[model samples]
Target chain A: MAEYVRLKPEPGRTVSDQLYQLGLEFPCGGCSACGGCRVRLVDGEIPITEGMREALREDELAAGWRLACQADAAVPVTLDIEQWSARILTDNTSVAFEPGEGFGAVMDLGTTTLVVELVDLATGDIRGVLAGLNPQGRHGSDVMSRIEFDLREPGVLCEHIRGALGAMLAEVAQGREVKEVLLCGNTAMHHLFCGESVEPLSHVPFSSPALGARTFAGSELGWKAEVVTFLPCVGGFVGSDLLAGLVACGMAESAEVMALMDLGTNGEIALGGRDGILCASTAAGPAFEGGRIRMGMRAGDGAIDRVEATEADAMRCHVLGGGEARGICGSGLVDAAAVGLALGMIAVSGRLNNAPLRLDGAVQLSQADIRELQLAKGAIAAGLEILRRQLPVEPDVVRTIHLAGAFGNYVRVESARRIGLLPSWKAPVAPVGNSAVRGARLLLLNPSRREAMIEAALRRTRHVDLGGDAEFQEAFIENMRFMPPGR
Target chain B: MADLETLRQAIIDGDAKTAGAVAREAVAAEMDALTVIQQYMVPAMDEVGRRYECEEFFVPELLLSARAMKAALEPIRPLLAASGAKPAGKVVIGTVKGDLHDIGKNLVASLLEGGGFEVIDLGADVSPQKFIDAVQSTGANIVALSALLTVTMPSIKMTIEALKAAGVRDKVKVMVGGAPLTQQFADQVGADAYSENATAAVTAARRLVAAG
Candidate 1:
């Protein structure tokens, strides 16, 4: 096994000389898209890699540099990728709604990101879209971490979250005439919003403040709107996000079977039929959002949105914004894993093939990247399998799979199917862009719709706690193999 | 007469049936219960604790052996009580408020009990005042707090402060453990000990008691 250590550059020490042991050229001499050349900062700084030069700013490079491609164990290096480099798509559209026109705003409070959209109640036409980092993320990135933070500060941490949401609402409204506000988020996020503690949501027999949709005056949250509605939660972990996704996909109205999935920080999936909706939330972590992986980014400019194994052992990438590839995002990650598996570039256990396959000119899929992707894909696949077992129908019985969220919007359905991330079904795959936002929009548009959402939230049943479910763990391990079952 | 040495070896080996029979034989022959517990049971559990710290044994094995030791001790409880034998210490342990996760707490309690500490497990969602009240009523030497949620961690600190306010903080050592807890955090919160797992909790408690 090849061992690489990332070193930080110091005054006396040169990075190029130290990285000589790794046997890579300074500029990595490989495809600039091959982000393998990036090195982690262990202690000192090294010169920036070509990928980092474009991805990072002058101040970031001046602080210290490390190649995203050629990391060496010779010294410690600090990581210096520009935060903006992680973003794939930039929305320049401004909020444009007239005040007192009965416009409403809907918000999806994700763990990593917060997205707010303004809609015209009469036509359901989107007026404006805005997104920002969830300020609560500074406390911790995952739900478990945030819960820990809440325990320490009591209501203090929750106040920070409310403030962030309030600011975003004010921004989205932008002096527009908003009559109602609708919000959709996970159960934990909802609990925090209502000033209810989330500690109960982390344990077994998980409980929430309320399992159904709730309504309060917008004034209650100090919003300018007349009424504010929160989409109902199904269980402690499976919240209104899944329900809203289901509703937006028109799953409730359809007699045909369907699965609604919101693949974000947590992979919340709801599979239902005319019988009823069964839901589960898997702790996929933030790997898809670029938390755990090396050189991973959100779907933004300079990110690798797609990857494929070329005729030779080389990898081809479709970069976002037509720039030098900086890092891979969630959709691109799925593509890389699926392609790697198909080409035998990665083993069922998620080990990269010993033979080096070029990503760009220089970077290659290391063992760590493979392991990270395995963990991510495994959690998702396991949740799907667990939900399948609890459902009354077979996998084939499901007629449609509606993928929601920005990550889902960018992923190619065939790549997802090829990776066994989703079950093999004959149903056509449809992308419902930000269904949480859409459902929130519905609540914003009509007071009756808000009430219906609350009622729908109350009716849904949450199935097995993914963390405590032994079968989920078994499925996770089985899915980690990455090969078709029985192979 | 095989001396205390031979009997202690039996207990350490976790041969509960043999240890119980030998203990009975020794008592019938006029041996003291306190001596059997101190010279035999405590030593055995101490070895178990050491083995656990070294990773030679995991949770299931430690739990099973503790069970065996408990089985042997059960029949001699009355005898030990009559002889006025005291436990090493008494502890009140539970998961903090708003957190209903208790597996970690239960495991630590079992290990503490096995280590000859009288453990009173209050279960999950225990309020800070409840911990203080338990310490006051039970006259426990230590309060073990567990919280799996970061959100609930403040409850651990609150319980400790509550104990301090009740004038019982000096009477008991505050020990906090959980997945999210670190030694630095425990120190910052003014806790005397922090352990990552149940076995470490036993070791930390023993060290705290010995130091006190």
Candidate 2:
């Protein structure tokens, strides 16, 4: 074949027309939401097309960055680039929490969402609770996208996240006299709060500078609280959230093997036993938070709480807050996937059955929806499989499967196991709603708990890069089959 | 004598074996290979590309057609080579530093290669110096950079600056793609092209080569 350099015809073909002809599949329909089209200039100065100038920054333009899907190869050019992956931390040291008399607050700053709780330091009672989407989500749905924005424009990220937390705290406090504050978040979040650069967090052999927890004055974060403590990060991907969950669930108390999973935007899993604890985090992406999916939404009012499909192609849904269905939440999605598989509305490979589901409104799960659910479930299951492979005994040896997080609280445990999202074992599954918040609250209530949490964090060993595990990929493919292995 | 109509129909049917046999017969009858390609194979591939763009055909279909086109072109390789027909352009592609994901990058490479670009893939977690070296060694006119993480985007800018420092900034066009990059960010990083997907990358590369 004549290696014809498919060049843009000057004064003849537009970049868009050429791209369309090239058969490019643009996810997001080029809505400019995801930055999947970024490209760079390598040879001979090519003028920044209007779209390039609009999508990128001046520094980026000066640095030869462009969106490959948007940029026209009409001009002479050479481009070098690759795909980026999310990084997780594994090592963490114990932190000390000193509780004082008076009202205090605990916060869990998650990638997709943020939650805050007001606590009475003397009694450990939660006064009020508030949850909302991370304001920085407007930049990108996931941590990687947010980090990308931060890299392009310095300082904006820290300010944006801090502002969001400040607003959330103000709402959750609601006239309470908040004296101290305790924060639990992933390593990237901690770094952003401390005004530390996240450059290292995204590189190979990812490491977080803050291994143990640290106490800072509330004034440091422009707050009036007397004390502010940032919980120590466990590892790059495994953050205080998992540690806090472990503490709240009392995973270290019993000698029996226990598996603790904090399922959110990032799925962090830690399996503990008499020998030691092994943990890993998976970039489950933002499917839980409804980022990439077509009809996904957060666990909020008006979101679908449950779904069931019947043999007659009939679909039923339960809405949260007894209102019209806005979208499907994470819990509802899990249920729908399991139920759909059970009812034969979806095939094992996550393909929607040829028979279309009929619902009251526009609440049917499409083929794409099933695929997205499969991906999310695959990642979680794969993480568990990786932990099992590293364990000495069989998965059944694990005594308990503690499900942490708000979404975990509502998920159907049986459905989760039915879909192979969790290990098929006789171990008890307990739902600890917002364990990170609870652990943070405990730290605020009892100063002694900080030492225990810190010890647990330090004693834990983190498993790196679930993506590299061949077992994870295998599990992902198998789990994507939606149906039971024997079936 | 067989006209372009009959040959075009054969190409459209994806009859690579028959197309090759016909092309060989035509050449033996003193017909031009370029005429056969421009009049038949390219048009057929264009149809396949169109079907792909319309979603009527998926990756498997596209791959099949591309294979067919390759098979048909095999018999005319000597004629094109003897004519010293140069590729439309050359590109070096890789994932940015700190990133090991390559599914998207691999897809883009496949589409670009199918589009007839001489692509030198650098795989994943490629450093700025590696990109420069690839560009220098391959004499590629375009550099396609992919990053799936926001944390590694700084490396993209650094690579661009490295190319400039090597005093070869004006010698090639740089393109960037991934889940976090935007056209605006691409411009800020000084990239010449920003495609949203693999198919678009091929289109963009072709345009860049043609513009040159």
Candidate 3:
């Protein structure tokens, strides 16, 4: 499904700006610092700048590959747009709801991806769905960078995301009478959406002043809806998405102690039950999403999405598209690390016995890649440990561990435990796919009790600031090893 | 004297309690503090650095060794000062402004201290003026800058420019390191050196001091 686009650059704007209008992603904030926005010139010519020269190899330059961030095409030019279409996890849980009139839209505004679902309120039937890369990625991929961008050019990122989501909601509504819209995102996304100052989130302790739930008249957002509501966040780093995840996982009603983990660049973890909950967010880095690894990528075609070890200690990689393995994704990375440990190619210290263990043709797991995983998983495991200590129950009393997000849904529980990414508690781990959307849908269906549930969840949860926590620091250092849980 | 071999092994094994005990015994015995550090402690750290470079040790191990070295150095630091012995070098370090992530920067600081540099850690979200004032007040010969986020990286360049504007750019060497940083980026931002990890950071700082 390859496509091409012909673009005429507007004055005072780079080609990346035009591409962003075309719903393209600039993973590096269009800074020309990364090669993620590279586009192949199919016809005509565009002047190359120093950024293009530095980012592209000689052969790539010879083949007309150019970084769109640095190019401002004066003449109309055709360019190949590869890696544009991406599959976002949109599976939702089926829950009974009290049917009402009109329609409602639910949105899960993630840092890297965005998913919106249109549903009939009366019958609780889904109408349409739209999922794609969040256009604000052109600003920055992570929340910290997005905060910095907003600090410089206030309201620019807000305009970008609001406009994008507004258009999407309108498209999903399709001129139907949409009564209300509900959204859930991280603290940064919530602040950006509300045009609130992100300065508080840019420092240690990361407590934001504007982290409360907000309701907006659809007229303000230029949507033909009655009202729009953003769910409230738990803490500075622990977002409303996790709160929605708690609702989706039925943690608020369960009397038994439980845990919910959404693993990503920002590893959000919660431990507790109806009595109380402790939530903390750890900077897990980009290793899980394949950002810092040498040859890591998203779970897509040609990407090694899974890895297994044979009895003879040989690795068997399963590519996403059943082709040659191009790179390893987060799930595959976890599995490979586990298999490497099983075969003695990796030590408990995460040291590779032989550096760059080849998993497939030209697809190898380097020593540094293993270190990245170690740091990422270590932060997550440490966060969980810290939260577990704060709970009233014993460590072994965690009845269930609900893994949220796409990474949690896809990563094997055994490999995660082997690498100490998940704890050794006997609680059966369950993958809860896209719980934020599911929770938002439930809230949309039960508008009468939505406010009460939000109040209850807020009252039952306490924010744990892991920054500068001595216990967390010690646990992080101790958990950085690759030893199996309970070791 | 204090069975310095045990002290050295304690540091290598990252046994902070044993390292601290041995160093305290050495201090009580009036063993020359400089001799203890140069002969036993620095070699242990060097071995740690070597292991880190060769991939035998990771960040946790490196951090543990640094902690053990810190514990061992505690009782000896006052003795060395009383003996009028000089430190290897004076370095000023901080995470650049608007960047709160400091784990990597802290590791680099610890390793630098273990490597025998007199480090003045200004902590995270450090403004350019703070760095300049610290250099002026402490007379630090080297400035280490770190930033973890891509958006906060330009502050490293701004700090360099501020150092130039303050007319102290030529007085001290500028070193930079972070997750989103590269050698090319360091050079682009006018940093004199870029180290990939904590051990490399110590080596770079030492090299910068030696070159001057």
Candidate 4:
């Protein structure tokens, strides 16, 4: 079954085209290969292609189901479209900033998703929130891939991202004047958006020296905002998003030992508080983002968000939207792996005891999937472990793990620790949802905080070269064992 | 004296300490270091490489076995040098510039060392000049290039061009391997071979040496 949305009737426009224009995330990126953009026709004659007939069942075809990627809108039709609710992390943190004249906008331009929040600065109220799959995704999924694409075709990335942000602004702004807009993203996204070449980011001694703040006018990016500001990037893969995360966590202000981990496709880990900061980006791959998994899908309706292993060794899945299981997302993947461990269904060496294990009779977990998860979790854990060694304070002395980003917000603490994705500690983990966006919002509300953040980012934070850390390699190998640390 | 079968089994089991102990015991029993490596250690690692190719052993298992062979080879290095014994081949390995990812490079180095190759590991983010310098200084038979990121994959060609400019391109066989590399890329970059993984890297290195 395909998800459908009822848009204001267009005489000749297709349902899929309308959704794509509205920024609905088609996982395959405007391709018909995955069939993720299927829509069910509620009323009117929508022509379905031969390819759709081959992929869809007879009952589905009879019930007016059509592949959105292939269907055309010939008449005014109300089709059931898959609604999107991008789980963006935006929890306010650090010192509050002063209101800047009129309404403001804050954006977190993640590699996969673009989340924008409209705020009324005068009233201190969030006017509206809008999110969509990054149209820049048509270029590539990860930073490295995006860099490669940028190197190949110079100007396309900036155009795509800027256009997508423009559409999003048009939707959420609702004719209201936004005084300023602030963006926080990884180094690649930041460079691509500002039309900076990524050639410097791709080779030896990899980093651009000129990663300071930049401001643009409304005419520049085709937006109504008076000014748009992008935060500074901290060398290597740890972009402005991480710097924003630091601002959100207030690493420079407090003497108390604290660590902030923004878990995502890249899994940037930073540790230390007052003495100094040791930060590194772990190439955790796309496992946690449901990349390269057998039945992996982005977190959305029908995606299995949670998994439980019954005492009888049965797999129970809790899907989003309370429907039949479609595919497992990141949180569910971790829970299933942890549950498999508890039941001895997966060996400590990351070999699944069961072959092609059926889950909820709708999904399957393969041995390769377990290994992918292990590799991903191991990289994150090893990165943290390496950061610990470089810090002046003992790792045990550090308290309050600030888990940033969406994956951090949703993943169970016990499961994360058990899987070694998060370092094993008794200290409370503060899941600061979307600290990047929150930090950007804070900066947007108060321009003064930007200087403070820049100062803090420059003086206090030190980028640890994990690529040179031998302890990291050892930690990575040792952590490859699926069991928790010291087991 | 450490029994030959027991030594081989120790290496196969990935027991580095036991493999080292057995190799030392064998040397103490009036056996030649080179002879011990040829009779037991190399054969064990070769079996592991074969198993990896056959899908009997995956990455973790293969890496473990490589570590065991490396440990066993450590005690014999001094003796091999004192006796003027030469390794199977000399391998110059490093992850290309702009790519800090060394896991693949390190794995290939470990596997090559286990296969009785003298590996000069340049580590990650090595420049083209550095790779050429290592090849010149070590007189390496093969230079294995690794790049995990697609953005950095072009370094393979740059390194190859450097090798040619130094008039040593033909002297050393170039083998490239990484997540995003392929045979077409290897051909385009003028590398002699392209390996899909560490185990295959060792095989390609051995084949390159043999062909030259």
Q: RMSD to native for every prediction?
A: 14.3, 20.5, 12.7, 8.8
Per-residue lDDT of candidate 1, residues B85-148 (tens digit): 7887889999887676665677788778777888999988888889888988999989999987
i-RMS values of the candidates, in order? Answer: 7.9, 4.7, 2.6, 2.3
State the lDDT of candidate 4 residue by residue for B89-111, as single tens digits.
Answer: 99999998878788778888988
lDDT of each: 0.69, 0.68, 0.84, 0.78
Candidate 3 lDDT, A209-298, residue by residue in tens = 788998999999887788889889899778888888877777776678889898866789999988999999898977888888899998
Which window of 10 residues has the lowest lDDT sum in candidate 3 chain B? B97-106
- Where's the lowest-lDDT run of ten residues in candidate 2 chain A? A82-91
Compute DockQ for each candidate against the true complex: 0.11, 0.18, 0.30, 0.44
Compared with the true structure, model 1 gives a TM-score of 0.60
Q: If ranked by TM-score, best first, what sequence of candidates would result?
A: 4, 3, 2, 1
Full ranking by DockQ: 4, 3, 2, 1
lDDT (10s digit) by residue, model 2, range A1-487: 0001123345765543343333222322343333445544555445666766777889988987766556555565444321110011112223333446778888889887687767766554455556676777788766667666776787887888777777777766766667888898888777777677776776776775656677777677776567878887878678888877777666655468888888888889988753677778888876766656666776655677677765675667777645677777777777777777777766654556562343335765656566566777777887787777777558678888888765666677877877777777789887765678766665665576667556755575555566445566556555555656443
CA RMSD (A), model 4:
8.8
Give the TM-score (vs. native) of candidate 3: 0.80
Chain A, candidate 3, TM-score of 0.80
Judged by DockQ, which candidate is best? 4
TM-score for candidate 2, please give it: 0.67
